[model samples]
Target: MSTKNKRGWIFLFALPCVILFCIVYAIPFIMVMATSFCNYTLTQSPTFLGLDNFKTIFADPDFRVSIINTLKWVVIQSTLHVLMGFIMALILRRKPKGWKFARVAYVIPNIIPTAATAVMYSLLLNPTFGVVKMLYEKLGIDTMQVVNLFGNSKYAFWTVTATWVFYSGFNMLIFLGEMGAISPEIYEAAQVDGATAGQADRYITIPMMKNAFGTCVILASVAMVSQFDIIYMTTRGGPGNSTLNLPMYLYKIITLENNYGKANAVGVIQIILGLVLVILIQRLFNQKKEIEEV
Candidate 1:
């Protein structure tokens, strides 16, 4: 085939995908944006209300709580997950006995469905019949009388946070893969300079894995913001809304209150926040790189 004809055929093949993306993703996004400006309950014809939804969401205490809870999840869970991943990668890098088995075991949690995992953890954390409470009792730790993890304001937030931490094997796998790609020559050079293992890890491994770290951080941040199913299945944003992350809060507004306009407004806010976070993370990574180069 002639060059022009070949190019035309390639474009024809790609057109379906582009059209599908517009229909599936872009159109829905546009609809949501449009709906955010209207007072619509999905059951009624929408009235163009121009930012009323946004104003109402901004003024709502529940919305503010959701924002705070989401921020907490993003900062705390992402930081701990990344740090733990790095540590696990470092330990597993040595190829110790049973390390392969251990890696497989680690990833098993991620493979399980989020709802299933939440259900399992819910049982484990049950205040009375749960194994966790039993173990605490055996260790002479005081256990709470109430068994409702989803109904306790004091422990609800942290309990949900803890459930996802041990299941952070995907992040660990990412870091481990990045660590494995580092050149052995660099480690040998560091050793020749009499650097300790810890120093080599801090100065060499960590620095060289910056790109992977950036990717992982952004992924974890987005996950924190959009996380819904596990929290929904576990807590339903309860314990007086202590564990109500933004996504769950948005869900409640739509399904329970039938406030479609407010839900769309929340979605718009989430999208904007996610984009801002991505841009901020990219800028920080670039600035650090420039400093190192200089």
Candidate 2:
């Protein structure tokens, strides 16, 4: 085909995607922005309030607590998840005996529905008649006051975070795929140069897997920020809102309190936060890439 004709055909082909983007993403985003400014309960006609929702959400103590909790989750959960995933990926990279079976077992958690996992964990962590309680009792640890995982605020948050860390096998799979794609010749050369496995991993594998690491970081961060199903089904932001992440808090406002506008405001804040996080992660990755190239 002629160059001009090819360009015209490409533009025609891209038109559908552009239209779909508008329909799927742009339209709903605009509507959400609009809803954030209105006082609507979804039953009543929305009345323009002009930032009142945002103001209320900012002033609400519960919302503030939710934001703090979400920040904690984003920082702690994402870091732990990525770190554990990286470690698991590294360990699984080598073709050990039964490696395939181990990989399948690791990813089984990710395959299970979050709600089901949460329910299972809830039972396991239950203060009464739970395996955890029974184990602690068997170990001569007091089951009455010490074995309450969900009852205590400090333990509850950590318990929720722990559940996510081990379930990060999906992230491990991503990193493993990326690591596998690296040219085997590079590792061989490093070995020839008297590099140890640890040294090669430190200098070669990690640096080469920057893109995958960046993707994992972004995914984990977003998942932490928007997590609802497991946290809701497990803790329900219990122990007096101590575990109330942003999404669960927003759910309460919209559903329990019938505060749709305020909930939309929270959603807007979440989107803005997510955008900032993604931009920061991308910039960090770009800087690392430049440094590596140099």
Candidate 3:
């Protein structure tokens, strides 16, 4: 084909993707940005409000609590959650007894829908006729002293955290795939050099899998920032706002308060926070890689 014809064909193939991007992402983002600076709601037309919405949310105690809760989960998810998956990948890579069965079992929770998983946990933790309650009874703990984990403000955040914190099967799978790609010759070399299995993992396996680790951390952290469904199903951000994160807070502003401008402001903050985190993770990984290369 002629150069012009080739260029035309390429554009033709790309047009649909460009159009879809605008329709699905770009346009909505633009709308959200524009609406965030206005006083908007379900009942009233948008009136320009400058930075008032931003100022109000910043001053709100609930918003500050949500920020703290969201960041706490983000840190926990990125570090502990990713570590759990990475450790699982390392163990499973050894292909010990029942490895195949274990791998499948580990992934089963990931395949289950979030809502269903939330419900399952709720039943398991229910104060009445629940396994946890039963366990308390068996331990001879006083029923009157037993606290409702999901209902008590003191325990609700941690209770919500428990539901998804250790479910790192997807991250495990990613790390496993990365570990598999590593050349066996490398391990063989380490063995020849009098390196123990632990040393080999520390010097070779872990270092080589840095990219995968960083990817898993970024994915896990970002997911936690926007986590809503499990918390919503389990606590609805109550007995107080102890379980409220940014997404749940935004949802309440929109649905309960009918405040589009404030909600969009929250949405904008969330998008920026996610973007900033991703960039920071990428930079940190890239810098480490550069240092290692040197």
Query: In terms of TM-score, which candidate is strongest?
Result: 3
After the best TM-score superposition of candidate 1, give how far the Cα of residue 93 lies from its true spot, in angstroms.
0.8
Please, what is the whole-model Cα lDDT of each candidate in the order they appear? 0.86, 0.86, 0.92
Is 2 or 3 the stronger prediction by lDDT?
A: 3
Tens digit of per-residue lDDT, candidate 1, span 85-167: 77778888888999999888988988999889889988887777888778878888777644566568887888888888757
Candidate 2: residue 41 Cα off by (Å): 1.6
Which portions of model 3 show Cα errors greater than 4 Å?
Answer: 287-294
RMSD of each: 3.0, 2.9, 2.2
1 or 3, greater by lDDT: 3
Q: In model 2, state the lDDT of residue 199.
A: 98
Q: Please state the error at residue 232 of candidate 3 in Å.
A: 0.4
TM-score of each: 0.91, 0.89, 0.95
- Candidate 2 accuracy as lDDT: 0.86
Q: How many residue pairs collide in each prediction?
A: 0, 0, 0
lDDT tens digits by residue: candidate 3, 1-294: 899999999999999999999999999999999999999987899999999999999999999999999999999999999999999999999999999999999888888999998999899888887788788889999766667889999999998889888889999999999999999999999899999999999999999988898899899989988899999999988878999899999999998899999999999999999999988998888945666798
lDDT for 67 in candidate 2 is 85
After TM-score superposition, the amount by which residue 115's alpha carbon in candidate 3 deviates from its true location, in angstroms, is 1.1
